[model samples]
Target: MLIAQVTDIHLGFDPDNPAEFNRKRLDQVLRHLNEIRPRPDMLLVTGDIVDRGDAESYRRLSVALGQVNFPVWPCLGNHDQRENFAKWFPEIPFVDGFCQYEVEAGPLRLLVLDTLDEGRHGGAFCEVRAAWLNARLAEQTDRPTVIVMHHPPVEVGIEWMNTDPAEPWVDVFRQCIKGKSQIISVICGHLHRAITCQWEGTTIAICPSTAPQVALDLTPIDAEAPDNRSMIIADPPAFALHWWNGSQLVTHFDNADEHVMLAKFDKGMQPLVRSLMKERPGAE
Candidate 1:
């Protein structure tokens, strides 16, 4: 099974204009995913669907999402309003006032989580939500499960955007999934950059945003001082592809823009390709 993911679209960044930059970037990515060979089985929009949570923005978002042909599953982000989102995306059920649910994808069980603490910059998982997750985890201890959420728990050293390790919510989340061997990976977004780390004996894969990307500077920033620094950049829009090959869930990050071809499989490269294939363990 192949899963395509696009995050932090921020479609209403320029609500007045019909041709907004973020919207264009999202369209570029959706077009590529829609036309790519072996089309993705589903698309996961990992939060921040709009810059401001508004009914008009959601309406526009719904129109933009119509370009894709695959199933789209979205969670909530700090920038999202649950009331407005529920109105626009009625298909997604909100359980107990939380946008959380489970999706059966081929052989894998996807636990889509709600990490949005509206009006706050960070994530939140209350005891109620944690209890729900615990119950779900207990249901099938042997099934390969993937937790999909908006915020990644680890701090990535981008001082301004890092998730505080001492936060109460992080502790709750840690306790909920600790020692769960069935969880193979946790797919997340909201960092606006592609990052992976080993946490709680599983992999946390963060997909880059379709909107502008955060600058890759790790230097500490002083709030009082106004030092000119690159905070955000218009890097080419990005996405992630997760391939489930029975035992492992391999993830790949990519940009949605066109790239210059440096190599091709032609008569000159045919011999190299053949030789590489023959070196595989079970080459025919």
Candidate 2:
């Protein structure tokens, strides 16, 4: 099973400009996905589909998403408003008002969780969301499941983007999933960068934003000198592809923009390629 994840679209960044930067970046991502090798079984638009969570932004987003050739599942981010998002994505399986549900694809089960806490930048998993996740995790102990959400449960070192692990919501989340071996990984976005770390006994993979990536600054933010800090940067739009090759799941991060190849696969590399790909006499 191959799953593609693209996040932090922030489509309506410039509310008035029709040809906005975010829209262009998002289009580039979708086009790249449509033409990439090994088409994804489904796409997960992790979160931050729009900037302000306005109706028009969602309207534009919904239309753009229709062009994808595969299924696209999206959850909410801090920037998304439930009411506005529902207007465009009414079919989302929202349980008890949160966009959290379990989806079964060929060899993997995905639990899309809503970590959006309205009017806040950080993430939160309230009692309702936490309880639901615990029950779901308990029910499906056999499948190699991946818990999907917007915010990274563990601190990512970016002082501004990191979430307090001791926060009440995060605490509850850790308590429920700690030591649970069934979960293969926790995939998320919100830091706006491709980050990987170990959390609670499993791996956590964070996808980069499609719009603009957050600058990788590990220094503590000095409140008095906020202007001196590096925040957002216009890096290449990117996404993550998660591949489950029967036994293990491997993830790769790639940019939407076409790469500038330094060498051709013709003449010079043919023998090397053949040697690597050709079957050995003793192999399966």
Candidate 3:
């Protein structure tokens, strides 16, 4: 099973201009996904699908996503407006008036969670959403599952972008699936950078955004600290691919930009490749 992710598209960043930068970035990534061999079995667009959460933006989102050949699943992000989003994605399932659902794909049970706390910039796993998740996890015990969401529960060290670990909702979310060993990983977005770590005994992976990315800064910053540094970068658009090779799940990050190929497996490199490959411990 293969799962690809693109996030924080923020379409309509330039509401009046059709030639918006984010739109181009999204198109580049979509074009790349369409051309990949054995393309992803499913694509996960993990939140902030548009900027204002308006009807027009969602309409544009639908049109762009219509070109994708694989099954595309989207979850709610902080910037998303439930009512407006529902107008375009009326087919999306809702539980307790929140965007939440489950999907099964090739031995993987994906539990898509809704962490959107409308009118706020951070995330929340409120009581209602958490209850729905608890039920979903209880439904299937033996299946390998993955949790998909927008804002990652863990702090990624970007001060302004980080969610406090002590938040009440964060603790409540942890209690729901703390010891559920069936969960293989938690795939998320919103940070706009590729980050991987272990939390609650499962791998937590954050996919990079299709639009500009959050600058990587690990230093401590407080309210009194200076704030003149750049926050967003014009780096190449990227996505994450989760590959399940039977026993375990592995993730890979890739950018959509095309760069000149400086090397290839031509005749000169063939012998070296053969020699290295044959030397593997599992080689027969």
Candidate 4:
């Protein structure tokens, strides 16, 4: 199964504007996905669909997402308002103050977790959310499962971007994921950059933002001090593709504007091309 992951759109940020930078970036992503040779089975918008918790923001978000041909599953981020998100996406099921849902595609089971602790930059699962996650994990022990959330459960070595007050909630999240061999990978967003980590014996991947990217700075500095330092890069919108090959999950980061097919095929590539043609049948 192929899943396209886009995150941190921050739509409706400019309420009065006809075109917002973030919304344009999102459109580019959608157009790129639609133009792909083989489209993804589903699209996962990790979170931060809107910058503020406003009704108009949610409405704009709904309209933007409506352009996609594939199914989209969204989670809430810190900047998101749960009530507004619910108002926009009434089809999604929420339980115990979490927007949690389960999707079964072939042999893969995707578990979407809501870690948005409204009005905060970090995240929390709480006791109820943990119990719900545990129950979900238990129910699908035999199936290969992938967990998707807005905030990553593990710190990615960047001190400032690390989860603030990362004590109790991080520990709780860790304990819930431990000893779960069936969880092939954990996908997340919210840092606004692409990152990977290992926590509780599972692979954790953080997708890049569809808007401007966060600059990669590992230095510890004052959070409030305006040192003329920023972690945002004005680069093209990016996303991640998670491929479930029935046994393991492999993730590839795609920069849509930077894709180029190199013409460097070697003699050894002929056999592989023949094999692919045989498998595809119709390919010449």
Which predicted model would earn the best lDDT? 1
TM-score of each: 0.99, 0.96, 0.97, 0.90
The true-versus-predicted C-alpha distance at residue 224 of model 2, in Å, is 1.9
lDDT of 1 by residue, 20-137 (tens): 9998999999999999878999999999989899988999999989889989999988899999999999999788899999998999999999999999989999999999999999
Model number with the top TM-score = 1
Select the stronger candidate by TM-score from 1 and 3.
1
Q: How do the residues 65-179 of candidate 3 rate in per-residue lDDT, one tens digit apiece?
A: 9999999999989888999999999998998899999988888999999999898898898888888999989988899999999988898899889989998888988998899
Better of 2 and 4 by TM-score: 2
Q: Any idea what lDDT model 2 has?
A: 0.91
- Per-model CA lDDT versus the true structure: 0.94, 0.91, 0.92, 0.86
Better of 1 and 2 by TM-score: 1
Give the least accurate 10-residue stretch of model 1, judged by summed lDDT: 30-39
Question: Candidate 2, clashing residue pairs?
Answer: none
**In model 4, how large is the Cα lDDT of residue 184?**
84
Model 4, span 134-246: residue lDDT tens: 99999978788899899887766567778754568888888888899998899999888888877788998999999888888777778687677776789789999988876
TM-score of 3: 0.97
Q: After superposition, how far is residue 267 of candidate 4 from its true place, in Å?
A: 10
